[model samples]
Target chain A: MTTTGSLANGEADGTAGSAAPDKRGHRVTISDLARQLQISKASVSYALNGRAGVSDETRQRVLDLAEELGFHPNSAAVALSASRTRTIGIVIARDPTLISTEAFYMRTLVGIEQYLNEVDSSLLLRLTGENGEDLDVLRRWSRQGRVDGFVLFDEHQNDPRIPLLKELGVPCVVVSSNAPDDGVGRLISQPEETVTLLLDHLAELGHRDIAHVSGPFHFIHEQLRVQLLREHAAARGITVRHIEGNYRYDDGADHTRRLLTGPDRPTAVVLGNDLMAVAALRVTAELGIDVPGEVSILAWDDSPLCELAGPGITAVDQQTMERGRAAADLLLRLAGGQQQLHLEAPPGLLRIRTSSGPVI
Target chain B: MTTTGSLANGEADGTAGSAAPDKRGHRVTISDLARQLQISKASVSYALNGRAGVSDETRQRVLDLAEELGFHPNSAAVALSASRTRTIGIVIARDPTLISTEAFYMRTLVGIEQYLNEVDSSLLLRLTGENGEDLDVLRRWSRQGRVDGFVLFDEHQNDPRIPLLKELGVPCVVVSSNAPDDGVGRLISQPEETVTLLLDHLAELGHRDIAHVSGPFHFIHEQLRVQLLREHAAARGITVRHIEGNYRYDDGADHTRRLLTGPDRPTAVVLGNDLMAVAALRVTAELGIDVPGEVSILAWDDSPLCELAGPGITAVDQQTMERGRAAADLLLRLAGGQQQLHLEAPPGLLRIRTSSGPVI
Candidate 1:
């Protein structure tokens, strides 16, 4: 076996050796070189596998020569010794267009990429359409060692992905806590506490009627936040009503149009996501409802969209970037075999933006 | 060298060496089972390599064994044998957050995933910060055989990534036409043409003195589109001026304040992104600017952001998903040795929403 540094100059080097050892960064394996050189397969195999039948002179010359010329084993053998495949698999539940609109997901993904860059790992993505035939595709690629681990996005309340992911034996981390399995590691935003704090902020504004517009009911984090808002509002002798919608701006607009223009209108509204909140701001404007004078809106998931909204939506900042980084760190630890399975990182900041003013 | 059928069910019939093996998945290699069992490595090697030193009965038994048990070789062996990875590496300029928020990028990625899934190949993403570090990471990973080929995202004018990627000796599909090397597989969206079409739509509506709020100045697509808009307006005898800003909603608001309140303001405006168009709507609402009468706005990158924008933004639908799928197909073909490298897909409709109308 010849252990050598990768060639500084990009050059094809072919030598017969049982295996080629490469420098960590620039590996060009013997098999790759063999293919490049068009050498006999058996000769290259004998040379690399270190079978004793090969002449000593030829073997020594091959090893020494490969070292001098920078021949290394291919990525497959390298993968066996090192767990990293230099790729990360990500699973998203919604359309690509939806993911692009959510600033939180965008920024958090940026954070994950920052860490991945530090380690020289790549990110692989899969967006599952309805019925999740895509999941099966993921399963096959993962089994074939196409990626190192997975970054699971937009978890549902009772995710069907969990059991299958577990059975497959790939390392993964979830963005939301809706379907947090005890066996799997998680990075959860403090959804309940975030909602409580938002309620307190609204309650302090002297709002008597507060209504919540939450994301899809299937999403556990939305359920938890909405439930908390209801319970907390009741404790303060305030009545709260919740309407279900996807975590989308249009949904927010639709819900707001229904809620704001009707009798028994709430003085304040809370949204499950920032997109929805921005929509609510637009709806309120269209209906000529004075914000904070007649009604106030508080949004969840403090993405940049909240900051850009006209009234500057008052939002619950989950610090998605911090959460994404933590998830990456935990997954790295697991991949390295340095940590026990199943870790839980805490929620981050609850930055309140400007949308919700003192309710008149 | 015993090949006795060690089926989990313990049937142990002599059908172990049958060429027609169990169809559940791949047959597990003897080496994997031997490693699992912690038996002597030499013994397992002897049985698997088909060396003639062992007894005939034991050899047949060993041959009969693992097949009935249904254990398959790891993907590494298959990859080496077939010389095909069935996986493509994508080097993303930004991280996951960008994937979720930037409609163009997210839609493209999703489209890429859609095609790859159909072919049973997977995408491998390597995220690099805006800094130049991503090139080195991609180069190293490509050399190591981590991916069959690559898809380059966010190609900038005078982009350094192009040169570095070229040196890696793998086929690549770029989301840009201004690539350093035009011969490589390219997937470029016709943004410049889209801009001209937007202008035609506006000019036909009797709008003059149009203003533009563009994305970052250096991005090749943004730069080209801006230039196209300026040229098209001059050709059409319509007055034009532009303010540079990011493709962000807040940037829209900021530029709107500058353009609307300032002297010599254009009656119509075109935004580089849908988010900015949405922001412009909010700004108009705040300043009491009437749409289509006093001021009108158009946006680029038709997405849900446009539809959700109160007065839906009139935008050039870039067929982002189709772009992504085309890129995926190109990379797969190159990796599969078909070698049809360069491609430019057609642009789709410019969906007219509530925002765009004739100037009074």
Candidate 2:
């Protein structure tokens, strides 16, 4: 009973009634186990680790001894014996500052952490220069048995990490923006539906000439949105022009200024994200243009910031939290060696607000 | 030369001329080495790892063989022998979503990552619920020898993590806004001087009554900023009011709406951070107020969003990137068992922009 209680404490660490680890960084080495159980070091190691050395009764006794000592086996030590580290790796493919602005990544991370916590698995976060240079670290982790598996995000078409993940032969889940049936497990979100909803909403308001300021063309999600917008705009016979931005606040303001100064200024504008949408409002104010009355605006992502902005912008709710949870679930299943093929988050909702109205 | 070159590749993985890690996760084990070099596994292990059983000639031969084979000693294996994992831990204490909007944390992470990369170490990032619940992971990593040191941020006075670090006997650096002087390898930023400069700037512009929308009282930086604001306001014989916020956009909007509805609204307002300040502009616009004419506004922590906001907010540039780098440098020095410390970033500069002007 004390052994079970202590083992539970070791598993559910950081709570009351949990067995505190030895303050001296003392590990339950094979020798330590052998000394305690009055057995040979090799015998204890093989028995506890389920190797071919000792009897079933000896293995049970060794395991019981381990539990009594409150030793939660080191994942790395267990790796050599084909055991779980109870950890997941996530590589953020950008600078922390840029990544932080998109609540989607953070919310998704929270979801992953929540599910991993339930399984008593911790997360190992790594940063990359958007160039997949950290792929080697992931490889080393696999070889050295550092992490049991990984969850990847922000992959481009023909991603280098995809082949690497397969080559490493590790259980992994890739979070994607588009439908990537990449053989490996993945979670995808619908970008086309968001664009369609925006076009419909903007069309209902009698907007013919519209401008969409989008992020860089390389990002899969950005490209998908742009493609969808062009298709819908052509089908509906709406005159649509596009401007490109680097997904920054300044980019939004600069591109909007360029859009307005053009020979034919559009009656409505759709910016890439919340930061750009907010920047668009600043541009409209500087140019003495009345929002909705002169030019309506729709943001890509709806956050509290959108609502907090003056005359809250009409935007699509990406349901980032749910998307994040789905990705985590996919990884959890994959890490368990189960094949969960693909998942898609529900289509984004069009949040109509004060920023969009009938074009005058 | 070829042997040395191959060894360097194993050591400097991801760089040019480095041999790729085995796709199938092949760790060159002692057995593998013994079989290849025609020696006993025990002799190979002892000679390669500097354990007592092997002669000096055998050790050199083992080392040469290892280099020739491009063998990289696993970090986890080395860790068991009281070696570093070459990883540093950083625990973020906030909602990942809310934390993303503030550029401060990310800038600091970049700083930490940059330094860690230079030392051929990697970063291990973890998310916390702001309650230090993630301390278990930190403790486990220490006992398991997963990381060599830590870079801590948002530390409260007498932070619980400080005592925990001392108990773990791990090298760490605590980054604080105020002069910590906590003897825990702290890097301080100039909060008081920034507050003073702000007051002086506003006072010079003939602003008598000013309001500071401070963050929650629990945060040490917020407390220091509020104290210094009160001190300077009192010294200058100016009427100053303080409002509290959780430092979110909604908090900015809700608090500003409250400030405006109140009978005594200050002529100018200072927000805890850039987001709150940006939200204040939206609230002002909703109330049909003209910035720098009816009300002057100042935001703490300048990001590009500050410049992109309507009329632009006069903000204190926190030099966040440099601040972050300093914190990282401090942690690195500590990790190397060096006593070099007592780092402080240059004082924040109050960048005067369109948002602040002569009081109407």
Candidate 3:
């Protein structure tokens, strides 16, 4: 309550309190920290901001020196500089209702928040209706100097936001499997390796034919996944059939219904996400088809739902949270003036559960 | 490229660009809009901020007039006033991993974002390890004038943050079932009514004995829920047994296993959340018990998992997103200097799915 007095008096902890200039009659700055540590200013900034490039020991030394020097960032002065707000922006261009149900974005947000919190930075979250609205929001925040940088999500082919972000000259990192090689930093997943992992698991189970229920083809990841699946399955001497899904439960149920009831149903079915896989399982149960006995099922993304389902669905764990944290780290480094930051997200792991088994 | 020039000069759209002073020589302000519209300044502010307690017609009129007058809020001027940062803070004192797995927080966030986005405001999200860290964050944000207000979550009995918030003098709204009536705005659910609804549904199915798998008892809502459940069940000639859970999948499975194997197993078990409910369904399957035939199951909170489960769990829809939106609206109003705002969240609806049936 009314902590202004304590904050202004520089309480003993040396945690972000206002203080008078040091013995040299000058406020300690990042440059001073760099000079004292004999490292570049960028390194000192990275260490202080808890960025990825700095080693733990270097970060500890930087922290110790800053504390001894009574160095604390003056946010008001920073704001006046029009350089850094110590805040990052993330705009999700999707229906709020849809976003509420999906666990992917939420997990990503947790990762981003965890990193920013550790660095004593803040996140500015915005949800928009369309790509155009997203640009508008970004422009407004940039013009207002409300954020130091942004973390981009849901990259599309020739994403319009890419050009806009470049034009705005704002630092950003795009988290997607299909991010363009434009100057911006990108955190991408290995689509070919992911596809190979899924295919190898199914092929070893003696499944010669498989059907894939993919997410909407407009998404770069979905397109890459379908293409890679076909390429990988062919090399494994297995036949692959493709069906487009919108990553919804009904899409999975409807496609599975058509596949199971039609001529020559594939022995194994792979879906784009956990929801669809669960939906496919429900469809199997409704039709009295034994899962993994009649048809093996696999989900693209692993979540609690996969394990909770009866005869737990086999899934590829994408490490969504880690990807989020890495993306945030890249964005922070980019904001710190580092260039060409590209990070390959950790590979997806095939979680073998009861849903995938030897073909009967 | 650089938007500084355009942002410094008023454009045709009259949207947030800097503009010259009007004919009166002084810059157009909210007072002018209020005088023109013949409404209180607070009403005009509410309309502009898209907060509750303002009619749609009035909001439209305020927007139309503001556009005509080229009245765009200058964020720089606002920030300098130390009154409105146009940013709301939400500190979720929970494990990041746990936050990612639970759909509840995500849905609430979506709701909060929707409201804040409509008002051209931003959400500052922070995830802390514990209550003490949460307090530190609030104090820091408050001291720095980084946030205009906060939205409190997960209230506990004899909550410590209440006094601190009051002393900080920062406006906030607590979204909880057991928020204290200490002058702060509260968006609370009807716990008694919720308990009665759940009991009535189970009793109607001829279930005389039931077990309640509840969230952590330390939560004020959980305490109120269990107490209300027993009081309501006694009048309905039902016996209620309580099992403490941490709102995890394992809690539901472990409790259900214990109950099913022990003597005088309840005819029905009500879980605290969807994850727990799904876990219980798995337990019944492992034990070779027929759902709704040997024992009935129900869940407290409804989510996609409830419907995806094999039998489709019977659940109480808490309208979490609506609650979140309401809390945001209340907080915005409080930040605008309104006081004593209290709202009752919509009552939970009992969604009777395939999992519940008459006692066998």
Candidate 4:
């Protein structure tokens, strides 16, 4: 069950147990294989450990040689000295009761787990409360060399943990797109760019004024997109009104009711996420606002709920899986000793469904 | 940040070191504490590890003794003998790409993580794919001692992993309410029980016939509830019709188009989950069927989505957070060296929201 690496320059030739072959099996070593193949011990060990130094041709030759000699490395001995554990550590905020409501966090975790499983690594998750208890536990665990590395989620700018994690020399890749760097590696979505594209698309559709319903202000990504929305609107000379939401459908509904019925109501609306957008659709329907003809709506982050919503929701597709997979790959490299550097991918997709149309 | 433990013997009357410490600096050790408290090494180690041999009064005294002496056990050394890695491995079916769709999985994971954090333990996650690749990976992980125990989800009757897990000698708690006993622990929730109660309530209102739309047959809970629906109807001598669904809104819409528009439309309907139930409400509305007057509908496994679907869906409430927390607590006990046993808790709630009413 354990990944193995061959030993260098060690051999008790098969002849040692040849006399009692039926009971006491012969021990095949890397040296025995090297000798049989007329190759060096270094080449045999390199091939078995999956190290990159050996050429593909030489690697195959070494592998074939080992198979012919019936060699199997001692898994325990390899484990004791291997540089990597192929395991990642995750720390979460306390309040086990929050698991059901926080759907986004759960999705991200599942994505990370999927990526790790593909690479044959395991995840270690630690829960900490808001008061920094989890951080304390993680600090102790990291110093003891209990795990190879970590994947950081729920990152706040200038997080108290960053300094300590840096001191421990633990490699990490952050899930947050806007978390400030303190020399640690990170992976996050492109919120600022995504918002700009969304605003521009809505403006091009002959809409003069637009309303925005956004997520909680404390989150860095939420704040980044909010700031960008204001800047983009100003540059385009479009009037924009922003409302705060908790990234839930009800918040979207309540805000929609207030805005749609108000004097000088905007012709279109943009929501922070699909859940909120779906709420907007319902509230609009209740108020007798014909979508696109009277008021158009666009949502960020296209989830399956968008398609299932009655008329289908026009939304931003944030490439959640790519975001997750890229994070996993980056974390793996960092754990394998790749130094920290900024890595950026293309912007997420804009999935245009029936929710948004030209302003009449 | 390390969790400190006390020394065994009474304090030693020795002068403190006012000199240079080791390379990491700050020499905090059981040896130093034993000298300060004049205690035996065995006594200090016992108190530090939270072992049971010492009396409660004596344990408190030793703890205070260590605190006063400023003793901290070495983290690496302590980890060697502990039964719990302070880590739980979670196995799931979906890859990270499908994270957004698997909302229940995410919520439950968060709940588990939240509770484990309170106890200062960590969670290790592994996604076994829908096709059994995850099973192979999980088996290898369990065998290699990569995790202390497991939290299993999406139980099917006589699941293939059950036998493999049993042989691995790893303690596990299944999330399914109808989890079969194959020598593992169970956490059961009977969502179908709500159907019987709802049907009886509707029957009392003079409803002579009902229709049921259920999830896939492979799901044990869905199967049990659908079976119970047929049984309950037969016993009451009431006409009932059952249809299969993929747990999707479209499935509900498609089935609604088939049954509701036909001549055999019943006076009432019961859905497998809230997602499909909401769709049924929309479809029935489009077909001009009068709800509660001409037709009454009931749903299962209520969530926030129920409330957003115009008229709130009357659903059987499965306390998601409580169920998750209980499973976590049981896992922690197993990690703490408790003998294994099968456990079940009742699916004890039926939320009678507006989606169901007396038949006219």
Candidate 5:
């Protein structure tokens, strides 16, 4: 019953045999291998270290035994079966430009690095487009012994990569997941109840017609938000509309233009992210629509970009940095062989700004 | 003599009787190893592949020969000694938060990935503070056979890491380099003389007191820009000032406030980047100083944030993304064992918008 917490702390004591897995447990050791081989521990070390002092005859036997017994001399110098490369992988399955300024990865990466640096691990970052290309890359990497684990981001519900990761026997911690049972630990913002807070706030502002301009529809949270908005609109007996966008500036501008200019336009519009929200502002101004006067805009992710705009956008503060660090903490636990990880993140808070107001 | 380009293209012909070192050179191959050991190519392949059919005696001998001859089994599978992990490393030695909103890394990374993906290579990203922690991590990674090469960003004059990189024999492509024959390629904006263009533009605008707010001062381009501005200002018989500031929002806002509100405030200010320039605009607005009316502001790195600001930030477009791709192409060539690489980037284009105007 050695806990992951104890194991992480015991990292410093590995050299002095402080990492014994209790006296009775059958964890193999260097001395045990030497005793079984009838060779000196020094000779075993030389063979394992790829040193030339060991005879060719001895080195082959050592490698075979080590391989059979599942042992590798990792940085921590623990005699374990796990071939720990001490590298973490994160794949971006989108045009990186679309989400580069989100501050999600920045905060999350810092948190991941803070823990990994303490444990002395490196990050392997790959940015590629979706359509299962990332899975193929991960498969190749696993076979080639590239990374020890992954910190998955932007994973959607029923993501196909879950099955592939399980199949490959790769360990990972996914952030903001919405799966039935993917066997992946998730670090996410709190309950789905908060979606109503936004709708209710807008509804209270005397809005009859509402619209939601969204990020990529493939993401579960984005889909969930869209569905919830529709449900709330139906429940409140208010007219609502949904427009799909790619989370790019063009996507937001084009969608905002079409929605705001259309005859049946909503008084208030909610954008998927701050970047799009900013873009929406430009579009609104271009269309001669006044903020909080004619067209009210609400943005997701309370990034600085939202506040810095002409009319500070109303947004949901997701606590990006805290969540990022939390992701790393859970990932470390999962990597340490914890079966279940369900970290509850700081819930989203509705920051009412000048962007949203009573319907004109 | 066979070139690296031909070898890269000949990746499909690895197993055949192809990949022979042509004409007047000695490039060892699997055939050479087989001939030296008086064994068949099948035995060599089996031994090198770590298959069960090859006896332990034969495998050990093959490994010894392979190591001695500097041969590695890379992904593309030509029988030369480059221990191709097919992983490229890039170290971000700055505060990622300050510059995350800029699309520079996003664009550059895409370019880097486009080429590396073509050759089936991955990117290992390490973000660290400016205290040279990245080099230490890279040294460990190099010893661990982690990455085959690097794509270094923002390299400066007399950088301590240059000697270390050379010492470690790691292949790299440095952007904005100012070293004397560091044996690395550079992907810089074309027209190396754009600094004078900015100064000349400003000087002609009747601005006697000019100032520069920049990114990290340790970076070569920033230093070079500061120097060139001073030289140009001296030539034009105008006064110029240099104040160091991290390219962060707070830094921009705080520095601009102090400079503009000071006893001898400059009529015009040039910032290190768009984020700062945007911050400067807010500060000016808050301090009741009209931009381009009371104090003209010019920013570097013509990012979207610049154009989207209250007053579109006048900037010099360095074509960051294209330069990043060029860096990757040059790095690939250098990794192919080319002796020298000097790729000039497209020069910066001075784009004047609403931010900067004549001194009133």
Candidate 6:
């Protein structure tokens, strides 16, 4: 651990007064306490931080002096020597414009922030540029000891960050089902159950043919959902077709239009997210199609937009906030030097609304 | 300015080798470089940081040694003595659940993050609990030198944070017109012009009576908008009534129902936000009232939600992302010790859609 030599040596030699302010008249620092107590700064730090190596009498003296002097540990100085910043880093790589419209990320951030607040830690948020600067950021932060741990999101298949984080030996928790269990913490959700619930709802509505407008298949969860949807549909004797979407409103609308206008229109359509479902609803209105009568529509994620849409969209309640809280809990445990944790979030629930019904 | 005397003095006396690792075999630190160069760590820091005290020759030598040794400055160490963290703080003292649904804040965050990324800075985000911990956070962050500056949002009438920030002497930029300009930076939006434009559009549609469902009056912007709306309505020879709304869908719907079901129903309704406008649309539909045919509905802010709504509600485009970028720019300037800045964002544009039409 590197520290400023001149300040500590000069002060230790010259000062014995209790709570003597630095030359600049700044707040009392650990060095000030160390100088007054005529002991090494390391011992003072160890005592204040409740670390081993300091005698009980010395620790008590340090605490008593700290209280009397009104000493607030400098966060930066503590971070440098103690190697803990009390800050967690989250780096998001996505189009800045799209991030604003994503209700999922927003809710997840709230959950993460709520837990961090309770723990008295700060969140260091970074949005990576287009050139995949996320990896670079992780390396720099790790080398600089800028953050104690990281919470990773939007996990891709065989995510490159996993290997990099492992090499750095940084405590990390990934909110993904696909991440390899290589000692890093994992927060997994039951996509299989989610897909089955949606399919069951559609089958019960007597829909034999369905089109799934899914998020980019590059995402692990999307791939899992698609695979599960086909397996479940086959069991129910229902035919299903998959269309790729980027989880945006325009693509959802465009895909819906193409499907409804093509040679074979599915009796029911399931969209990847609430925004896409709202877009599909608009397209159906534009095409003069009667929802739930001529066709049925469902959304994979539930949000206020789905509930507020003209013909309220039937959706799967993913319990996004709860998932966020669970991820945070697992991350904090991992960061606190606990064993690598694996938490499975509860499966989604089907919310039936006006947009889905018996196929006429 | 406190440093570890033993590590530096011991290393400076013993080390003359080129790029010698510390005893722990950890990454190279500024102390390592200083020891190799046989100089004080402060000189090395000043040279590497390109500060004024270092000579040209020394600065070049420091730069060359840093490059050859692959030395990345420790952010925490630099923060301690140099007093610059390259991190900006933002504290939001609102309910976590409401934060997730608000698109305005989401867009603003994107804008702020975009600018910070370009400037190679991180955002330190904090959400205060119900006890108004925001002021405490600001004070602690300032005292700890955790952030170089702060970007404040959701300005309230006579906000207590203003005085606290000033007393702390921390660089700050407030994103509000109502903030008292006492040397802190300000990013003001033209609420008066925005109100005039919306009022003109409604007047052109022959709507003589208008009901304004505004955000909580405690917020300065909402107060300004309500005041402006009334002033502009009177000039346009229109009668206006104000209803308090919490900027949530539920309150917006309830307020709309009360206004529409009342005996003296206004021909036009102006909502505080896009979500509220969507709720008002739903309420009008539930009451069997035709939008634009009986009562015109307009939103104060335009988002994708507004465009996706049935009949596409008219709204005022507030340039939310741009406002966020501007606030970030101003905050960065203030943190850099530039002159205090006060920038006026362009007036919101009136976006006319099918929801506003001639009153029958």
TM-score of chain B of each: 0.73, 0.75, 0.78, 0.73, 0.73, 0.77
* Candidate order (TM-score): 3, 6, 5, 4, 2, 1
Which DockQ-derived CAPRI band holds candidate 5?
Answer: incorrect
lDDT of 2 by residue, B88-152 (tens): 77766676667656666656565555434323356776665554556766776788777877787
Q: Is candidate 3 or candidate 5 better by lDDT?
A: 3
TM-score of 1: 0.69
Clash-forming residue pairs, model 2: none
**TM score of chain A per candidate:** 0.73, 0.73, 0.78, 0.72, 0.72, 0.76
Task: List ranges where model 3 is wrong by over 4 Å.
Answer: A1-83, B1-83
**TM-score for predicted model 3 compared with the true structure:** 0.79
* Deviating ranges (above 4 Å) for candidate 5: A1-83, A99-107, A130-132, A156-158, A188-193, A231-239, B1-83, B99-103, B130-132, B154-158, B184-192
* DockQ, candidate 6, vs. native dimer: 0.33
Residue-level lDDT tens digits of model 1 in A202-224: 77888888788888777777767
**Candidate that beats the other on TM-score, 4 or 6, i.e. the better one:** 6
- Lowest summed lDDT across 10 adjacent residues in model 5 chain B is found at B1-10
C-alpha lDDT of residue A191 in model 1: 62
Q: Which residue pairs of candidate 3 clash?
A: none
Candidate 6 CAPRI grade:
acceptable
The residue-by-residue lDDT of candidate 6 on B238-341, one tens digit each, is: 99898889888899999999999998999999999998999999998889999889999999888877887888989998877777766765666566555535
Docking class of 1: acceptable
Please, what is the whole-model Cα lDDT of each candidate in the order they appear? 0.63, 0.68, 0.76, 0.64, 0.68, 0.76
lDDT of model 6 at residue A297?
88
Tell me the spans in candidate 6 whose CA falls farther than 4 Å from its real position. Answer: A1-83, B1-83
**Candidate 6, number of clashes:** 3
As for DockQ, the candidate ahead, 1 or 3, is 3
Candidate 4 lDDT over residue span A281-346, tens digit each: 998888889987899888876876676566678888776555665565566656655454334433
